[model samples]
Target chain A: MKTLVWVEHDNSAMADATLAAVTAAGKLGEVHLLVAGSGCRAVAEQAAQIAGVGKVHLADNAAYANALAENVAPLVVDLMSHHDAFVAPATSHGKNITPRVAALLDVMQISDILSVEGEKTFTRPTYAGNAIATVESTDAKLVITVRGTAFDKAETTGGSATIEDVSGAGDAGLSSFVGAEIAKNERPELTSAKIIVSGGRALKDSETFQQVIMPLADKLGAGVGASRAAVDAGYVPNDYQVGQTGKIVAPEVYIAIGISGAIQHLAGMKDSKTIIAINKDEDAPIFQVADIGLVGDLFKIVPELTEKL
Target chain B: MKALVPVKRVIDYNVKPRVKADGTGVDLANVKMSMNPFDEIAVEEAIRLKESGAVTEIIAISVGPAKAQETLRTALAMGADSAILVETDDEVEPLAVAKILKAAAAEVQPGLIILGKQAIDDDSNQTGQMLAALMNLPQGTFASKVVVEGDSVTVTREVDGGLETVKLSLPAIVTTDLRLNEPRYASLPNIMKAKKKPLDVKTPADYGVDITPRIKTLKVAEPPVRQAGIKVADVDELVAKLKNMGVA
Candidate 1:
């Protein structure tokens, strides 16, 4: 059986997680890397260097520039007929398109897989990683979305594979990218950062948020985060929210500032190696899970801590 | 134009779920079951789209055991015009649920389908896109805003680093994100009226879609518990401990 792994890239550069997806696909069968996007020659060339890959297929087109599922779905469906399984990184786009491909093939999909036990069985988290469930899919064709953090990226051998410019299979139709409003921050991304500084509703407002969270993140060279309560209160953007419904982060060091931890919030960050909680309320839920707890007013304590650092 | 919403019944978000003492699975014997919080957002968005005059009707659906009708009823009380129950006694995997929904959509033929980004129980945010793929339609996921105009729907989604907006033609699927909108509580009068709203229940077999799960679950285990730590008096002491632990 041959596994078709989708390589996700920025059109100019490949996503680091795609390497992890390629490594996970190696466990099932012989792997073929599929690079789909305009100006993806370098990505296909990079995929060919992964140690276990058998071949590389490039479907570069102008229609793929925006990468709406409308265009990518048909291409995957077209390619899937020749393979026994399909795999993609469990990133936002991968989560969006992989299942669609599975539905197109009339087979079941196993998503957010953390481990592959055998050729047909896998383990994944349930209830926001609170519990683990092992599942086996018996269909002849399998589709899975691999958790990038769970697998190591395969080493690159620096080889170039055969590149093909497959024609666009479907119309781009009406979709177009209008504009984007990205949060500009000097800190690293929350997912990959070694340290994270998160605030909660106790921050009061966005203007006041910079006082404690910013300097502390600067001290630790960490990413900034917010509880859903803080985000809902307009203290930060939705992307900054860390909770069951928001992003899952497993940083090395995590600091909670003025956040009364909710279970949903803890579910996302409890995996951090070291946790520090700063709050006035001694009974705050965050202290229960934190490795270090400081009971005091953050307004008074944070400035001193930032200065001391 | 019409809208279709799919809801799932999951462990109530407020409850701290516990594994069975026997290590069989989560203890559901007396646990509270409610509509997945994200699905509530989806239902709320569909109703808002209808109230904005873009959609003519709204249909809510759930595919699970008979008890899932309560989840659909919650949708009706919140403002869905009708409901359909795809009754099944077996555990429905994400793919099977998507297939059954595809069958349901083939019957309803709505202009748009809305679902929560993921069901909290399984956290598999795949069904919406799967249904879209099965129906050969466009999809906009993790959408905070969905605007329907003419034959196209513009959806604003929460992507990494920031927000990205995509426009899809009619008959598309949109999965709701957390900031989409705060769902309203069902009023007593609305609840009373919802009791009279039509809810059609049918088995998955009726639609020729198999509800059997292809995946078998071997075990369910809780994450290792985190040990409680000490409370520090001041920043100096905390940093001292951190330095000693090689974390500073």
Candidate 2:
């Protein structure tokens, strides 16, 4: 079987998620990386060096600058005839593009796949991570979005693969990029961070959330996350959400302050190396998975902890 | 301009589904069912658009078993002008649902089509984009905020890093995000009024669509259970443990 993995990049380098997807793609068969963007030759070169890749397909065009699914879906479709499996990291870009490719192929998309039982069979979580379902595809071609945390990142450099430039993947003049408001990250990105400090609904308001959460994150030099409840309560931006519907992170040390640990929230961060949970309720479900569970008021404990750190 | 909103019936968000003894699937029998939370947001957004006069009508549609009519009724009570049911018991994949919805959109000539980012049951997260692809229309997915003007719509989408605003021409599709809006509860009067609202039932056959499953469920199982870890008495103990791990 042959596989094509979408290499998500910022024109300069690839996202770690893409490397993780490569690890997954390598599990199936011969892996080919597709680099789609303007001025992506640099990204293409880096992708070509990935250990498992057999070849790199560069769909270089100005239309792909934003990695807009509208434009890149057609590019993936154009190459669909050549590969038996198509894979991408389950990032915002992957979630946006892979479904369109699957739909255009008239196949059911196997999304957020956790494990590859076979070339056509895979495991994924449903019911907001409460249960796992193993599904098999009979479709002639497979399109999958892989959960990056479930797989290790493939080696960045090894055997050199040949790069080919393929064009004429027509512009999809449907939607245009207006703008984006990205987090001004002074610390590392939450998903890739070594340490993460997260708050939950009990943080109350945005002011309190920042006042209580940010100082600890600064002291620990950690990325901050919020449970979906906190994001919904307007205590944090939607990007800060860490739950079934939000960014999944697997950090070395995860500290949860005032979090009740809904199953959905656990789906995102339970894979961390070590977890410390602090909440007033001794029975908070977060303690079930925490290495250290402290039953205390976060208002009292967090400030004291921050001063000590 | 008419707004087309596709709703779905699913296990309620609050319910913890139980995997069957044989691990075939989650047992749906006697489970509490409700309109998918994301679809509720979609319906609420369409109603808001109608109230703002940006949309002249709001049409709610669902493709499922007869019980799905109850879901549509809820949408009607929430302020949809009418409803359509593509009644089917066959498990229709998201591709087929998108095709069925595309046919409905063709008949309605809706200027805007709204749907949930993903149904809670299948979690495919495909219908809106698939419908957009099939119709050859623009799509703004995971939309937290939507604004409309003549022949143009702008959607603020919730992405991984932050918010991204995209501009799409009218006759497009927008998928609702959790932050779109807090859905309104149906009032007593509206619930009564909804029963009288126009509801048309059809089938996938009427739309010339085939409800086929391309994927097969090989097995169903529970996610790996994490063992309950030890609880420390205080911060000093916690820090001491972290220090031993050398990751602090």
Candidate 3:
């Protein structure tokens, strides 16, 4: 089976999630990486070094600079004639593009598979991770999005692969880029962070949430996360949200301050290696999954814990 | 110009789904069903656009069981002008649903199509993008804010890193995210009036589309349970435990 993995990059550097996706694609058979962007030769070069990749298909074009699904899906569909399966990371970018590819190819796209059970079968979480479903595809070709946290990252070095220049499906002229407001943070990215400090609605306003959550996150060199309630209440940016609908993080250590652990919130971070919950409510559902439960007022405990750390 | 919004009937967001004993799938018997939350936002956005005079009419659509009419009525109560239900009993996958919606869009001829980013049941965030691809139209997905100007629309999308703004020509697709708008409850008068609104029921065959299962379910099971751990007495103890774990 020949598999094509879309390399996730920011035009200059490849994302860690792509390495994890490469690991998932390695299970199918020979892995080929597709790097499509303007001036993204460095990304293709980076993709060529992954341990098991056999070939890197580079589509360097000005049209793909924004990575619009309109242009990228046609390129992927054209490539699907040679490949048996296409795999991508379950990031926002991947989610936006893979379905379009599947629809164009007239195949069903499986979103966010956690495990590759066989050549045709895979397991994925549904109903906010409360249930897992194993599904097998009958389609001639398969399109999948891999949950990066569920797979190990492929070795960044060792094996060599060939990079081939492929022409892009230039400018579909469907959507135009306007502007972006990405948060500039010095801390780690949430999905790849080793430690995460998450706030909940109990943090009150945005001011208090930052005052309490940021210092602790900084002290631990951790990523900042927030419950959906906190994000909906305007305590943080939408990117800081960690829940079923938000970013999923399986950090080495996850600290939940003043979080009551709604099922949706737990769905995102319950896989953390060690979970610590500090809440005034003794019976908060978060305590059930927390490895270390601290029943106290976070206003006092979080600051004190930050100082002690 | 008219706006087309597609809603879905799914297990309510707050309900905890249970895997059946035989592991076929999640048990939906006696479960409270509602319009997918994101679709509620889509309907709300459409209604708001109508109120703002950007949209002349709002047409809500759903592809599900006959009971989906109830979901459509909810959209009507929320102020949609009319609704269509492509009734089906079989589980419709995203690609097929997109095809059905493509046919519906052809018949409705709306200037804008809005849908939920994903239904909470299957959690497959694909329908809107797939429909866009099938129709060869531009897509602004996971939209937090949408502004419709004459022949184009500017949408603010909730992407992984942060917000991205994109402009799409008329007859584009936009999927709702959480921050789009807070859906309002249908007042009693609206509920009473919604029953009188026009609801057209049809099937996939009417659109010359085939709705078949392309994926076979091997099993349905519960996720691994996380065991509760020890409780620390104080902040010092918590800090000590973290040090021992080499995390801090």
Candidate 4:
């Protein structure tokens, strides 16, 4: 079986999520990476080095500069004739584009698979991680999105894959990119961060959420996350949210401060390797899953912990 | 311009779903059902557009069991002008749902089609995009903000890193994200008024679409349970435990 994995990148370096997706694709069959972007020969070179990649298909065109689904989905669907399955990291770009490819291919897509059970079956979370469903696809050509946290990252180097330039499936002329307001942060991206410091509504407001969570996150060299309550309360931007409806992170060490740990919130972070909760409420649900629970005031405890660390 | 907003009736967001012992599926015999929260945001956004005078009418639609009419009534109560219920008993996957919506859009000829990014039950996050694909329309998924001008719509999307703004020609598809807007609750009088609104019932056969399940569920089970660990006495002890575990 030949599997084509879409490489997520910024026209230069490949996103870490793609490496994890490569690992998932390796389990299915020989992996071929598709680097579809403008001026992205650097990204294609990077994709060619990941371990287990057999070939890298490069589609360099101005129409793909923004990775718009209208433009990229046709490109992927056009290439589906040569492959059996299509795999992509379940990032925003992947989620936005893969379904279009699936619809065009007249196939059902399996979204956010946690494990590859067999050639056609997989396990995925349902009802916001409250239940796990094992589903087997009957589609002749499979399209799948892999959750990065579920698989270990493939080695970045030590592979020599042949690069083949593929023609771009020209612009679809449906949508056009206007502008983007991407937050510039020095901290690691939340999904790829090894450690995460998450705050909750109890942080009071945006000012306090930052003052308390930022120092500790910087101390631990971790990504900053917020419970849905915090994001809803205007304590932080929506991008900082970490929950079922928000970004899902499974870091090595997760520190929850002032988080009440709703089922939706736990759905995102319960998979972390180690959880530490510090909330004044002794009976908060977060403590149930926390590897280490500290019952106290977060305002004081968080600062003190940051100081000590 | 007419706006079509798709709503779904799923298990309430607050209710924790329990997998059946026989591993068939989630037990929903007597579960509390409500409109999917994301769809509520979509409905709210459409109402806001109508209030702003950009949308002349708002029509809500849903494809589910007959009980889904209650979900549409809720949308009507919230401010939709009318509704359509594509009644079905079989589980409709995203592709089929998109196809049904595409057929419905042809009959309705709405200027905008807005829906939830994903339903809470399946969480597939595919319908709106697939609908856009089948209909050959522009799509804006995970929309946090939407602005409709004369012949175009601008949508601000909630992407992984931050926000991305895109411009699409009118008669486009926009899916709601969490940060879109807080949905409004229906007042008692509005609930009564919703009963008098127009509701058209149709089926998959009416749209010439086959609503069959392409995926077979072998089993459904609970996620792995996480065991709670010991509570530390103070911050000092917490730091010491982390060091011992080599977490820092």
Candidate 5:
């Protein structure tokens, strides 16, 4: 199987999620990294160094400045004829673009695949990760979004693959980027972090969330996260949400501070190696999955825990 | 301008799905079914558009079994003027649903189409994008904010890093994210009025779409259970435990 792994990247560098996609694609067959962006030659050069990748396809275009699905879907469509498999990290960008490409190919896409059993068979979670379904696609082209956390990233500094320049950079005139308001933080990104400290609705307010959670996260050098309730309550930005709807992370350690575990939130972090919970309610569902559960006020427990560390 | 919204009836977001004893599929025998949470957000956004006088009419469309009519009625109660039920007992794949919705869009020629980013049942986040592809329309997926102007709509989408704003031409597709808007509950009067609103039921064949599954469900089963551990007396004990396990 010839697999084209969509290498998600900024103009200057490749994203860590792409390395996981590369590993998943490597399981299929020859892997090629597709770096589509404006002046992404540096990113392409980095992608070519991944161990399993055999080649790098560059679709340098201004239209793909933000990886807008409208502009990138056609580029993916143009390259579809050359591969039997199309795999991408199940990130926001991949989720946005891969479906359009699958639709253009007239195939049902296998999304958030947890494991690849065969060329067409895959295991995926549905119903907010409550049930696992094994599905086999009959489509000629297997278009899939691999769960990034489930696979180890392919070796970063290894082989050297040739970068090929591909054309078809026409804008659909359908959509345009209107800028972004991203959070400015020094902590490791939640999805890529080795450890995570998450707040819930119990954080009371945004000030408390920062006062109680950020210090602990900083002390541990971990990413900060929040449950959907906290985000909905405006205690944190939507991007900080760690749930089935937000980011799924399987870090080395996941500390649930004040978050009562909903199945939605559990879907994201239940796969972590070690889980700790600090909540006032002893009956919180978070305790059911915690390796170390502390029944106390997070405001007091978190600060004390931070000071101890 | 007319806005079209698609709703899916799935196991209530609150109810955990129970894999059937034989594992053919989820056991919906007596479980509670509700409109997908994301679709509720979509309906709310469309209703807001109507309330703002940006759209003259609203249509709720659902592709599922006869029970899905109830889902459409809920949408109508939420403020949609009318409803369309694309009847099918088949396990319709996203591609097929996209085709059916494509046909509806062609006949209605709506200025905007809104749908949930994904369905909870299958967790397939492909229908809206697929429909956009089939209809050759622009798509703003996982949208948190939508501002419709004369010929274009600016939508703020929920990306991984942050919110990303995209301005798409009118007659585009917009998929709802969780933060789009809080969905309003149907009042008694609106529920009664929804019964009076027009609802047309038609099979997938009416749209010349074969609601066939392109993917085979080999098996469905329970996920691995997490082992619950002992509760620590306090934070000190918790940290001690983490250190002992070399996880701190």
Candidate 6:
């Protein structure tokens, strides 16, 4: 049986998360990374470098760059018969297309999977991050979206696989990328980061936010995050917002400052290996789940802590 | 312009869902169901758009068992002009729901379709995009603000790294975020009025849409517990513990 891992990219360059998905797909069967995009030969070459990959199937085209399920779903559906299962990182684009492809194939799609065992069973989180559940996908064709943060990224070696071009689907014009303004980030992607520093509304304003949160994250080489309240207040961007409605992140060490720990916010980060909460309120809900709770005002604590680090 | 908003019935957000004793799924037996909080925001945005006169009609759609009608009525009571219930007892995956909505969108032919970015119960954040994909329409996901100008609409979207704006012509799909808008409570008079509004009942078959579980759930188990570490005072102790754990 062959397992296909979807590779995302700018068509010429492979995304780090896509490589991680290929590394994860290796556990199930001979991994074949599906590089879909316009001029995707580079993506195919990079995917081939991952140790466990057996082949690189390149579906190169302009339509792949502005991937809408309309164009991508049919292609995956057409190729489904050749692969026993499919996996992709649980990013926004992957989440949008994978389920539709699964539905088109009339099979189950297990999403946000964290671990895999054998060909049928996988483990994933539930109730936000409150509980973990093991699931078995007995279907002949299993479709899934793996949480990119859960696995190690694949490293490059000096070998290339045969690049095969595939064609079957065309854009149905469901949606088009009019334009995209990528957020500039100097640090690693939040989901892929090993360290993360987050702040809540208690930071007061953007200036204070920059003073306290940004430097902490920078010192720790961590991604910066904000609570929904902080984001809504315009202290940070929506992408920086971490909660049930925002990004789900799990890092090696998560440091939360001034967050009162709403269940919604906790749902996003409770999976971290270690949680450290800094809040003035001893009764703050975040302390209940934090591996280390510092009972002090973040205003004073953050500045002092930053100096030490 | 007419607008359509899709709603999902889910376990009340305030009521924490629990895995069942048998481990089949979250225990929903006798659980209080409500309009997903995010969907409520979508309804609020749709109604606000209609009230602003940019829209002339507001129709709400929900795909689930008959009980989902209650959620639809809530939208109606909050000022939706009409409601459509696509009844299905099985777990209708997000993609199938999007397909069903695509057919419903064809039938309604609304100028705009709004949905919550994600359903808290399943956290599948796919319907709005899938509906757009299935219908071959433009979409803006995780929209924090939506503005309509002439024949085009601009949506401010929240992405992983920051905020971005996307523009599309009319007949676009917009998914709501938590901060989109605060929903209003239905007044008693409006609740009574909702009973008189038209609520069309239908099924996936009516729209020629199939409700299939694309992803099989093999098992549902609890997430691993995090072992508690000792509390540390001062930076030295904190560093010592982190170093001991090899995490610093």
Tell me the interface RMSD of model 4, in angstroms.
0.8
Q: How high is the lDDT of residue A28 in model 6?
A: 81
Candidate 1 per-residue lDDT over residues B115-152, each given as its tens digit:
99899888888888888877778889999888898999
iRMS of every model, one decimal? 1.7, 1.4, 0.7, 0.8, 1.0, 3.0
Pairs in steric clash, model 3: none
Q: Mind giving the per-residue lDDT tens digits that candidate 6 earns over B138-195? A: 7777787899888878887765556566677788889887777889999999999999
CAPRI verdict on model 2? medium
Cα-based RMSD of the predictions, in order? 2.1, 1.4, 0.8, 0.9, 0.9, 2.9
lDDT of 1 by residue, A1-309 (tens): 789888888777677778778888889888888888888788777777777788888888877875677788788878878888899988777887888888778778888888889999899878877787888888879889987657877777755455655665756574666666777877888876778999999999999997768987888778999999999999888889887777778787889999998988988898888899999999998988899999999998888887776
TM-score of model number 2, chain B: 0.98
Error of 3 at B167 (Å): 1.0
Q: Give the clashing residue pairs of candidate 2, or none.
A: none
| Predicted structure with the largest lDDT when compared to the true one | 3
Q: Give lDDT tens digits, candidate 5, residues A1-309.
A: 999999988799888999888888888889988899998999999999999778899988888878888889889888889988889999999999999999999889999998888878889999888889999999989899988898898999987999999987668888899988877889899889999999999999999898999988988889999999999999999999998999999999999999999989999999999898888999999999998889987778888988887
lDDT of 3 by residue, B1-248 (tens): 99999999999988989999999999999999999999999999999999999999999999999999999999999999999999999999999999999999998999999999999999999999999999999999999999999899999999989999989998999999999999999999999999999999999999999888899998999999999999999999998999999966
Each prediction's DockQ against the real complex:
0.69, 0.75, 0.90, 0.86, 0.84, 0.43
Taking the tens digit of each residue's C-alpha lDDT, what string does model 6 give over A169-195?
666555455566678789878777888
Tens-place lDDT digits, model 2, residues B51-122? 999999999999999999999999999999999999998788899999999999999999999999998887
Off by over 4 Å in 6: A131-133, A136-140, A167-171, B29-31, B88-90, B136-138, B147-156, B164-172, B203-218, B243-248
Q: Quantify all predictions' global Cα lDDT against the true fold.
A: 0.85, 0.90, 0.94, 0.94, 0.91, 0.80
Query: Model 1: runs farther than 4 Å from truth?
Result: A46-54, A156-174, B245-248
Q: How close is every model to the real structure, measured as TM-score?
A: 0.94, 0.97, 0.99, 0.99, 0.99, 0.90
Arranged by lDDT with the best first, the candidates are: 3, 4, 5, 2, 1, 6
User: Where is model 1 chain A poorest over a 10-residue stretch in terms of lDDT?
Assistant: A158-167
True interface contacts reproduced by each model, as a fraction?
0.72, 0.76, 0.92, 0.84, 0.86, 0.38
Output the TM-score of candidate 4. 0.99
The true-versus-predicted C-alpha distance at residue A236 of model 4, in Å, is: 1.9
